[model samples]
Target: MGKSIRKISWVAFIASIFSFSWALGPSPLVFSSGNQKELWDELLKYKLWGRDALDFNNSNIHFTTVEGYAGTKKDFTLRNGNHIVNGHFVVGESFITDTGPHTFGDGYVRIGGDLVVTENAKNNTTFNDYVCVEGKEANPNNGVFKKGTPTLGSCPGFFPPLENDLDIPVLDLNKLSGTELADFNGGRTEHVNNGVLVIDGLPDNPEESRLKDIYIGELNINNNSTVLIHQNSSNNITRVFVNKFIYSDTEWDIKVSFDGETAIDDSTYAGTLLFYFHNGFTIPAGDRTLHGTYISNGDMILKDHLRMAGQLLSTSITIDADFNSEHFRYVPFDPPLVDPTAFANYILQEGIEGPQLINFELDRPAVIDVDLKYWFEVPTEEDVANYGEGLINANDLASGYPTSETNAKEVFFKKGQSKPTEEQTIVIIDDEFVEEFEILVLCVQIGVGASLPNGTTHQCFDLYIADDDIYLVPEVNEEFDFSVYENSEPKTVVGKVKATHEKNDSLTYAIVDGNELGTFSIDSNGQILVEKKENLDFESDLKQFVLVVEVSTIFNKKATTQVTINVLDVNEKPVFKKGADVVVDENSGEYFEEEWATERFSGSNELNNGKGQNENHPERPGEPQTFKFIVKYTDVR
Candidate 1:
């Protein structure tokens, strides 16, 4: 019941002469081929066809002719296990090792068909005893094909067309101004002048031109320049789309790098970089190294001494350079090309037909019964919107939850059945709005029922019914600066946080952590106001504090941004200390006279002796009594 072992077959062809109809549901697939050539021709009609690696669990495959091929155009990799190919299993030339030549197909490969290597075969790894070539000559140059008994049957024969088409919005370079593009790079909008950006040679400041997920009509790199595509996170992929082409003068001169190093081979120097080209990609002449995946719709021309670690997928390839296999490795996780038209058509058509057919096949034979359980759902509008904004919580979506029931669908095989037909199909119907359906298949031995578990597997696919185009989250403007003088008037308008959504959608604004510190407040109009002026002291508080403002749509979808408020310090008047009573002996006239003279000279004579005659005081004794009087003074300012 392993998810990888499930064999979903598509009707490739029907017997040429005979045909039958089903009274109910869809009709079964039937094929009759006059020769192997006819069978191969029919199979090629499908976008994808053949047996997965898990199909060899209990049986061996036989490759009868050199032309007899099965599998996908995409690269297939075998990690560290012995895989059996009973008959002739012809695959595409792109088959290569995930590790190195010595580690490719580390396990045994037993074949039963007349081993034939096609012109497209291009592997140099040695299979050693791992491959038991039975019929034809097995050479290192052609590939390891050893003669062995056939255990597995022929390939699944037919497979459904891939859902390559998904309607993803493409960026229009002409519509976007240079300032918009620079904003995407987390740079000041004014860095790019006019509507175009040009780098004649190596940038004097590399940080000035760093960007990701942007569209460039034409990019020309000269004079040993470097272009970096930064990965948002370890798992997040960053892509740079070039509408026309990428031009460079020398091979190793114009280097392309990634922010993080390659996970393969534990290399500390190389990073991940992905470039998608609408046209061709010209590899410069000289020794060069590329670490990520390069996808092109047109042909890729490679020059001398090119070393790569990821993958290259194009309409065609032309190699004029020396490929260093030691440094070059294959990466299977490259993103596939999407056809939006096909995706829309598939969704519109399938939406009315309920659930399409899903086939389940066991890798190993067992006398068991299978039960289908609801696994999960996908294309959640909230999740999709959050993912676009880099706020997706993978754990929340992965938590086991039953999305929907099977709704009385027919199961080809039932409980208490022993080794049922391998080609049984199941009809799946779920909720209409659900864009993806995941189901878990549980296999239990006969008489055990559901008490004990034998094997469990799960599969998920997009229903493709969600209307993602219309459900857009608001876009909030980022980074606002609010300057204020220390001890300014209260209730002053600092700045406004602005955001926009669809024309018809209503929005409300609020500060995220507004209540934590009573420094600022925002109204529904996003007008930020100072609440307390006394708290805005430049010396006592930080020079700047960030305010996180969020704008939410009526439907609860929201976007957030940060604002910084700077406080400017101003000079203030000096303060004076209160004076205390001072007692001086009358005999100490010299000291008193000196102090009085100093205070008068300094213009700080705020002291008084009781001898002064005022309206409320009578004249003291003659010549001012020489008594020890108290002197009180305040510091002069």
Candidate 2:
């Protein structure tokens, strides 16, 4: 690519650091052409032509026509009527020979005006080259900038004069609406007296659309008029050229605003806005505003001679001194895309919010929302209706389309109806309930080429989540168990249960019963043992009972057993009977048998004395004295 022809850095630095060339009024133009090489030969003949020539290979410029010396060229001056410099114009050495008092500046160079050569004793060649300058006029009308073909040391003389009879194209300003003008085709134009000049009409040709894409070239407004440009096309405006009146003592100015309004302060030009007049031209000195609107996806190329009085708020600015001899470049401004995570957090950090739409759908209708904070993407119904479903992806979520404020949420996808084979499914569960909830996640396998009894072709298994862990159902007890008796009391009983599904966790145990006869204790080893308590009632007549043992894992699982206790009986008390004698039969007084009737151990009164234990002394009849006896019974241990 050709190196972009911008103003020389040194020239710009000089122009910025010091003031020069004011004597020439404004900018002056001298056209030259003809197979570039031939034009350079003619230009080199001038005295005021620049002494420096570029060293580029296959060079087009042979000499700098702006340089010259005084006292070596003819003493020339300007006339009042129509004047033209048909050939190379330059000055000789001594810079000033036949002119009035002159001002010399650090970074300034003066050209134009008829050449004045000095006569000296040494150099005899009085006239070195030709030079022309506009006559000093009391009132210099704004000059005209004309375009023509190339020529050698001058503009093409054969070309027709500029179409001066042209009329300003007119349009109904009211017809243009919404800050946009269209349907133009270059057939109509709105003449702006003041304020902004916005050219939104369609180009005269679609090919021009390429030139206007994302940019509209700088507009040349009528005297005292301003232009504000923006574009939705592809081409970016590289520069702007203006033609206006040249005042010997005054300056030219302009301004620009990016989005309209008062975006920038006025800018000033050191020269006049005119292009003709080889000797008398002016560079603006005051300031003007540059109001422009930036394209979302384009850059700008600002030309030179445009100065900012206030702020240069823009993406960038560029200047060129050559192309069409203008100094203004403007282009569309584009904003940056934000990071998805940061964008999401910016939208959802404060509160529980619903899905947010991030981008727009093109072609088919679609809208997508993204929670970048959690890396979540959601598609709306509009998107599904237009783009089918699930068309929004991570990339789209990151774009945040439509507007920067997150209001525009629409976009399109190519094949929204197609299922994505690579996406992984996730099951969201509340972490807080993991301990108590018995969640059964069924793993359903759909067989490829099989049919079930019910005509379905699928199989499923249940997985139970218990004890803060996952397990398959239908587990069995597989641990070895040994039960030994210590003095007729139960000892340790050990075992382990195997789960159907292999899960990573440890077994836990709890004893469900202990007070009842059948209740037992289970240790951490999954062991069960009966507790022994002394002095427990063991009588058969007393109420008999048993112990019940229940064991299970941490989640209320249980395997049970019964423990029995035998009740036995022993003697508790004893009783004795008292002997009754024959005293009651005394009245009958039956004759006593031989030997004084000693009493048959039944202790009859006839053989007993007053003592409770009867020991017979004599037998007698009649008076019967009561004899008392006691019956006693004792409890045995």
Candidate 3:
């Protein structure tokens, strides 16, 4: 069904009124309109674009997943009849062309950045009829080709078609750390680099169910791996977020998704699933096929041979294959257009590290369910912007709530047991990494089935969390340096690294750098030793070593320092090769000419150029034969 759009005249008003009356009484009207709702109208008309991609004169402005405004230029191309299909191509920039006979299919082109000829795209015949493929130099031929009135600015970023203030939840993969990313993505930091990832948002029978969101810390798409966006009888959407992107080589075909329903309402899968990457990644060349929209926050590399059945959007796309219909099929996405609503009910919460602290007082002596919501950001700004009002009372707020930056997610938001709960009691954890203080705010919201008399009607209670954990940073002793001659014994501790630590706090040492070749090791006692003794070559180009060590306390407070290890030089007397000069130091050792050491060692009778009797054979790996001689020199000093 085509959408009847709404305007954003009531969003701020809804956001402002979060008192108990609104939660227990009025529900926000479900109409399609907001900063992100414009997407539905534009997509229906084939308009996908970056912000400001159109000519400055266009009235319709759209936003994208990327932040800020990006003006358009001659950035993309339509070669042959590849993208000429039952779809439209919209970009933040304008369409590109060469002087050749390029064939464009039946699809429409809406340039978000710039319009070349601008005369309504030859009455919407093709992209070239409307947008200038050429840059600011002005296509003189545009006057002759263009035929219709000009229109612009049709595409934007991650806005869902339904109401809820474009709230698809813009979770930036680049900004969040691995620990934070895993919290939202199934509470896992590692998954599916080599195995199957089954995201079954829609289950077949009653035994099956739906999934909210899937997250991956770092996803390495490989040929041997399979990613199935499992289908369901209930029409639910599948969403996945990946923090880091990498490529791994394997020897097999990779499965991307199952039958993904093309549009939001449809249960059949013809096309239009999306694989959005925050960082740049690659689709390796193979005898495999993939379906979905490929959008990247950074540059993307498309290898050859993998057939695709969806649209692709990115900052820079490098197609390392033939641009034809057999390789790519342009299918735009159709998101569900409906109203999603929310309301507020209080759920007092504290961290689950110790005993649950926030005690609840029920108004009716009955336990009621409440909704718990969370987002990653500093609590102060987040509180004011999302939940709290202006400078008001602190006593009424979440007790031990952080007004200072010291207790923010940017500083000490650690890992804890954060999960879905319907109980009135909630837990907000303060991690051990928090240095100096531990504090945070846990906001409670009522949505869907929550009601009034269970809580916020005629009476409101002051919520307080009893917390007394003061965190501090761990301290480390100075770096220790020790000198060892070449061929030092492996597994022998050269020196110990000391650190001042609390009696209750345990310290761990790790060699962060200068041990890339697996030449060094550090144990629990901060003992530095050689893992590979052969690496300590005195004559090697590197004469000194600097080991950067990282030390962490039991509380997760960390500090780093360096250890310098210098190699002492060893002098070698010249061997008797014809007329080799043997330096005879009085205190050093006895020096012998070729005549005296003829039968000294067992390997060779004569010092044949100092081969030490083992000329063609090195006794050890790099070591020749051992040279033992008697002292025959007297001190002259």
Q: What lDDT tens digits, residue by residue, belong to model 2 across residues 195-225?
A: 5555432224534321222111122344455
The lDDT of each candidate is 0.38, 0.26, 0.40
What's the residue-level lDDT of 143 in candidate 3? 34
lDDT by residue for model 3 over 1-637, one digit each (tens)? 0011111112332353332211110011111345333432232222222222222111111111111112222344432222222233444444544332332333334443443433333223233333322124233334333344333333223211111122112345455567646554546443466666655545233334232345555655564766566543223334456667666655323223335422121112323244556666766656555555455556566555444444444445555544333444333332211101221222222233433433222122111122222221233444434433321223224354433334421111111111222222323454323122222333322221122222211112122222222134457766677777665778877788887665445678899998788878999988988888777766677778899988876545678888988876555232332334344433334434444332222223244333322233333554434446442322111
Compose the digit string of candidate 1's lDDT tens values, residues 254-361.
223222222222222122244556666768677666655465556566654455544554444444423344444332221111111222233212223333323332
Best by TM-score: 3
Candidate 1 achieves a global lDDT of 0.38
- Alpha-carbon TM-score of each model against the true structure: 0.28, 0.19, 0.33
Give, for candidate 2, the lowest lDDT window spanning 10 residues: 365-374
Ranking by lDDT: 3, 1, 2
Tell me how many clashing residue pairs each candidate has: 20, 93, 29
Candidate maximizing lDDT = 3
Please give the TM-score that candidate 1 achieves against the real structure. 0.28
Which scores higher on TM-score, 1 or 2?
Answer: 1
